[model samples]
Target: MNEKLKKKSAKMTKKDGYKNIPSVDELMSMKQSGILIEKFGRKLVLYAARELQSIMRSNANTNTKDISSSINSLEEIVNKYVLKDKTIINGTGVIIHTNLGRVPLSSESIKSINSVNSSYTDLEFNINTGKRGERHKLLNAYLNILTGSEASYAVNNNASAIMLAIKDIVGKGEILISRGELVEIGGGFRIPEVIQASGAKLIEVGTTNKTYIRDYENAITKKTKAILKVHSSNFSLKGFTSMPTKKEISLLAKKHNIISIEDLGSGLLIDTKKMNLPNEPTIQDSIKSGIDIVTFSGDKLLGGPQAGIIIGREKLIHKISKNPMARAQRLDKSALSALTTTLKHYIEDEHLIKIPVWQMINMREKEIKKRVDAIIEEIPNNVRRVKGTSKIGGGTMPEAELPTWLLSIKIPNINTEELLKNLRDLPKPIIGRINDNNALIDIRTIPVEFDKYIIQSLNKLNKKYK
Candidate 1:
């Protein structure tokens, strides 16, 4: 430590440090304080002041000569808390990016959410009969229309849906699942753990690389409640891998008179073929294949609010809905509203024009190049065009890649990492992938509406560098 720092530390008592702490009202009068108050309210400003006071006390032993610099630090701290829930630009080509809010809700869904949340809604009331109604009933018709299922139920998330299903139908009973199909998705949610949490015993059958129909048949006992099939959406096993088909497993479950549930992790509603990609089995296909109960996520591939949709045989769905645990996992009015609109887009065949996920997935190279050209026209220097790939993220289609155009940036005096950090630290953070010692921004993931913001951010960077 410097001699001056040492002497200053020796002279300052903890009480002396407290005396230097600024009042919350003093911070409230600083530049950008009104913006902070509007963003986080006065309550958070006071909280931030106390936090800063604590930090000042702890660091009292060193450097307190620059009061202006310390105030700036406190202002920065307040801004960070205000931006905690703000949206950032996804220049990173990973669509449905988990870390950055998986599945951006469509505008129509947002409208629906706003409409429902702005005022009183018929959340649990039947306007038709002037009677109390079920909350899940709102999605039942839309789900059945889009999925060809006899009935449907809504929950807060896929994990809760699965837990309720098992606790209702397979409590303390055995659930036969293929060892090959056992998967650990993002956030470390393992299939076996979920089953165990639901009070069901997992009956692992066959090898990790292969499982035959007979493997499941052999494992079935009088205690067996269901045949559980988990779609390993996040990963795949190549070469010499085999697992029982949905048809085979469904037939086996039918013969045994037990429930069959398929956990379609991504819950893709659109046919991948229509998007010029390989097929992911749709909920309709699962129902046709005799899956008695099906649970899937609403956000991934569906491009809706976070939810778990359960749609299958009417009897089984009713039974699952009747579970006491279902109430604990029920969807709120906002989620239900968003999900209903999202499903309606599919039913009305308006998703192609309305849903962002499918629109981005089907983006052509020519279209992406046009977007890139538009961006380059504004800020041309150091922005190199290149061929790159985007992904269908959110633990779905781990192998699927979308061909696209990308902008690789090289700021003259700054390292790529620092440049990337600068973009991320912008007022509206621009998130991009680092490739080949450059920051690669995939325009496919960037909405056309944000093009001006991207240009403005780059222009500001250019000015700063100049």
Candidate 2:
């Protein structure tokens, strides 16, 4: 160290070190600070510098090595806040991954969103009559044809759709639900809580494993207003489990003069069985079973934008639409546009080719193997092709797994966690899982266009870590 710097280090005490830390203004004067300011703007750069200063002040050794290093630390903090919602590559092979932004929009859907969002068409205005119109009407015809329902309405998400229906239909009345159907979806959102929040009494009937139609019928009374059937979309009950059929539940609800509502959490419009996946109930089948009101998610099996679709009898949907909560929970123009385009793909029998979720699900094992083999050949890392299974994630068909091929990578010097971290630290992060002390990358959920990024990230890691 230099003579003057050595003296400064020697004189630095705990309190002296705290005072020695650079001020936000002093740090902002440095050359590195200019780069950060240009990228994140002055206000954010100043905030990040102060945040770092606060963190250093709390520590006894607050004396930074140099101004350059302090600015670098500030850059790291600012990047974290700025790129909090940045897009990432999904190598985890979980199609419809909730954490990774469930159900990526198709090219058509993206074009539709960009087209409608860039300028203005007719969001709430009727172009033909030049009058103010309802936004939900845009999707009504598409949903009616897709689900064969008398009418349809959309909200922000499936939970909102259910809440609106329950609040409007069973106001202050009792709502009967099967004990097994009292489900807690992702994010700890429980069915009972929603019912209670909707200003209705939750009466859970039957046992957790067995809920017969008689159990629902016996629970009805003068206070009963609706019978709720929540699909176990995120979970499965295997052996010795029993529940009444949708038809039987619908019949019982009709016999009692109460509404029959089904929350088909992941609304499936196509036949999953044909894709070799486990048989999942479809929205069409639910409506066909005489369900009075059916609710589901638009982003799950529908492969659309995030939305809650409510479709059933016209009168019931109209009643729910008039509720004040409907205005608060309604979908915006961009989501409606994207959802409409996604629905058109299905109507044209092009979902398998046009939707990302279905494309990943329908991808052949041989095609995936070919891609994995090519990725292994491109990178210099010690990677090999291995057999793996991709899951249908986002609370739909939890137990189902699709056969896939993955690249298993092992670096000689780095551990699994460090290797994974390095991959995530790349410019475009690569998200993968570890198995048997090796990093596993499943390309099933990744787009073909992003394959180059995987190759580049792995090569960078091999050069640095190896």
Best by TM-score: 2
**Tens-place lDDT digits, model 2, residues 1-466:** 9999887776676677777788788888989889888988999988898898888777647545466668778888888779564778888999989998897999999999999878977888988899998787758988998889999999999999999999999999999999998999878999999998899999989999998888988889999999999999999998898999999989998998999999999989988777889989999999999999999999998999999999999999999998999989998888999999999998899999999999999999999999998988998658889998999999999989999999898988889999889888877788999889989999999999998888887887788875
**lDDT of each structure?**
0.85, 0.90
Q: Global CA lDDT of candidate 2, please?
A: 0.90
Per-residue accuracy of model 1 over 1-466 as CA lDDT, tens digit each: 9999977767766557566666666666766566667767888776777787678777664424445555667776776676464878999899899899886888989999899989999998989999998787758988888888999888988988888888888999999998898888668988889898899999999999989999999999999999999998888788999988888888999999998999997988767886667568777789888888999999889888899888888888888888888887888889999999998889889887788888888788899999898888899688878999999989888888889999888888988999999999987899998988998999998889999998889888877887
Residue 387's lDDT in candidate 2: 99
lDDT for model 1: 0.85
After aligning candidate 2 to the native by TM-score, how far in Å is the CA of 97 from where it should be?
0.5
| Worst 10-residue lDDT window, candidate 1 | 61-70
Which candidate has the top score in lDDT? 2
For candidate 2, the TM-score is 0.93
TM-score of each: 0.89, 0.93
Residue 441 lDDT (model 1): 95
